[model samples]
Target: MTKKIGEPEKDMSFLDHVEELRWHLVRSSAAIFIFGIIAFLMKDFIFNKIIFAPKDPDFITYRAFCKVSRFFGTDGLCIDKIPFTLQSLEMGEQFSVHIWISITVGFIIAFPFIIWEFWKFISPGLYEKERKGAVAFIIVSSFLFFVGVLFGYYVITPLSVNFLGNYSVSELVERNIKINSYISLLRSSVLASGLIFELPIVMYFLTKMGLITPDFLKQYRKHALVIVLILSAVITPPDIVSQVIVSIPILILYEVSIFISKVVLKNELKKELKNG
Candidate 1:
């Protein structure tokens, strides 16, 4: 059984702890399955409205880019169309893709519940004060993840689709993009951005564990910039605008991580001094 908040802590054997974890996993999986079924039922909206939105020339991101270009007295940034066709060659490809896409959407939608399960499993090991911060942690983490997802969907996906879809090495080569390939690109972008945005949270926990310090982050800031640029290049299309846009937020997150580490260390120091 799940422990209620503010209840007295109970000690358990290793096997008992494993049993507790099993239940948490079961519940989290159940939540994902339920959401997946809902996504399966909403196939049309999930596919045409969301997964394929970046390919449209009139997607919000593209239109915003066009407006920015017009403000600068140029229409060069405007995309008229994505010069590629998405096709499925195999007979069972569409059905398989549909099932996988539903599961992916379900995972995204159920992320908060997954995090809650994670917190509950771990909170028993934390101090009373730390356990009380569960609500804050869940809210902040979920907010960052969703923001990252939107950034990927709106900013990164459109830029990449526009660049790669228009790229041509030879007139003889036709851009018949496989449906699986297109979906893979979109999935990677959205999921990668969501995880990348968790840098500060990761730093906080690392600091608590004495694994990292603010000074360490500061000293490696230049190296981190290089890595971020390389990562940006990998995730985004080979364009300066796309790389810069992606890099800016990641760098900001790195800086925010440093600050979070500093705060965590300071709090720890205060606790040590009080105890001493």
Candidate 2:
């Protein structure tokens, strides 16, 4: 028989545990599928308002950058236009892109449900006190993910699109970007940023399992900075301004992870003392 929620986990056999996990995966997949359908139905909004928005000179990010540039007594950051045209070179490319974009949107919209399913699978192994923090974990993680998505969309995506779209090797060269390539860049930026923002949660769990400690994180702080800069360079456009902007938030997240690890370790120590 399948183990019900709140049932004692001790009674579950190995097979039963596998069965439970399978059900959680099924539900998560179903949620993603349902959301994907919804996204597929909203084609105009997704394509025109979201996917193509960054290419416009009057986009919110571009406007904001222009204001900042003007405030600094220069129009260096002002974007006039993105000098590129998106083309679909294959017959079924547009259809394929539509399906993939819908799936990506579905996954993003269903992220909370996916996290809940994952928590359900693992919560059985945690202590009661730890389990009680489930709601907080879900809320904080989801919030951070959304914030990171917005940051990627508004900051990194614009910087990258503007620079790459306008770049030219020579006056004779024209930029005709493939739709697949453009979408791929945007998707990677958004998803990578969202996952990177979960640093604190990952640190807490690693600390709880005694796999890592705050000292370990602190000792490698400089190393982490180097890695963050490297990561920023890889993700954003090859410009000092773009790389620095991306690196700052990631470095902040790393520091926050260290603090989270410290707190988790202290709490673990207190619990051990009480038991001893």
Candidate 3:
């Protein structure tokens, strides 16, 4: 029943809340756009070096896989080359993709700032103790996102490029990979994995809201494992090695989410006991 600081001793009208949200959005958007411009300026390095790195046989992921295969006395996991070339069909498609990719990269680079802006918008509604966790929220979320992006880039992307790039229905037909299509694959892999890696954060909130519990997660462990495998297959190659590599991290994240739910529940119970 304590009045929140900056509550003005009066309830804010709906329009006032909307106005506040609009400024947060504006700031977040500005951050993304500024970083986008920086990415646009480095178009050459972004495109040829970072974006297209997975298409090269000697990419770090491929080299690591080759070394691992050699250690195992098998070449099955080694990727020799990606057998497709990227081409833009439409006149302005390449330019359009360039602009969009820059924007996407900017969003990724400015993620921490965006999250901070969001936290600021929501923090006023939270208790002082809850607001104190904002820093941890941003740090953990950003760390998971970057890890997912790196995993998608280094592991999933290479497996996908190697498999689909070399796949042929018939020897007579050659695969012509469109520029936008290739970019789309890369974008989906990185962004989807990054978002998926926020499992623990999601679980924490769900636990706080009384919507989920550690027992619930534990009961559904088998189902979650099946779903994780399906997701891995969707993103990476159909091969066991690639699917297993992707699935391992996701499975670990699920376990982590369960642990987080337990911790949140324990804290909630402690707070209830103290209040009572």
lDDT of each: 0.92, 0.91, 0.88
What TM-score goes with each of the models? 0.95, 0.96, 0.95
Write candidate 1's Cα lDDT for 1-276 as tens digits: 334454546667899889989999999999999999999999999999999989999899999999999999999998788999999999999988899899888888998999999999887667777888999999999999999998988988888889999999999999999999999899889989998998898999999999999999999999999999999999999989899999999999999999999999999998888868
Which candidate wins on lDDT?
1
TM-score of 2: 0.96
Query: What residue runs in model 1 are displaced by over 4 Å at the alpha carbon?
Result: 1-14
lDDT of 2 by residue, 1-276 (tens): 223347583688999999999999999999999999999999999999998899899999999989999999999988777889999999999999999999989988998999999999998777777788889989998888888888889999999999999989998987999999999999999989988998888888899889999999999999999999999999999999999999999999999999999889899888888878
- What are the per-residue Cα lDDT tens digits for candidate 3 across 1-276? 443434456777999889999999999999999999999999999999999998999999889988988999999778767888888899999999999999999999999998899888877777777887889999998999888888888878888888889988898987788999999999888888888888898898889889999999999999999999999888887889889989999999999999999999999898888878
Using TM-score as the measure, name the better of candidate 1 and candidate 2: 2
Q: How many backbone clashes does candidate 3 have?
A: 0
**Considering summed lDDT, which 10 consecutive residues are worst modelled in model 2?**
1-10
Pitting candidate 2 against candidate 3, the one with the higher lDDT is: 2
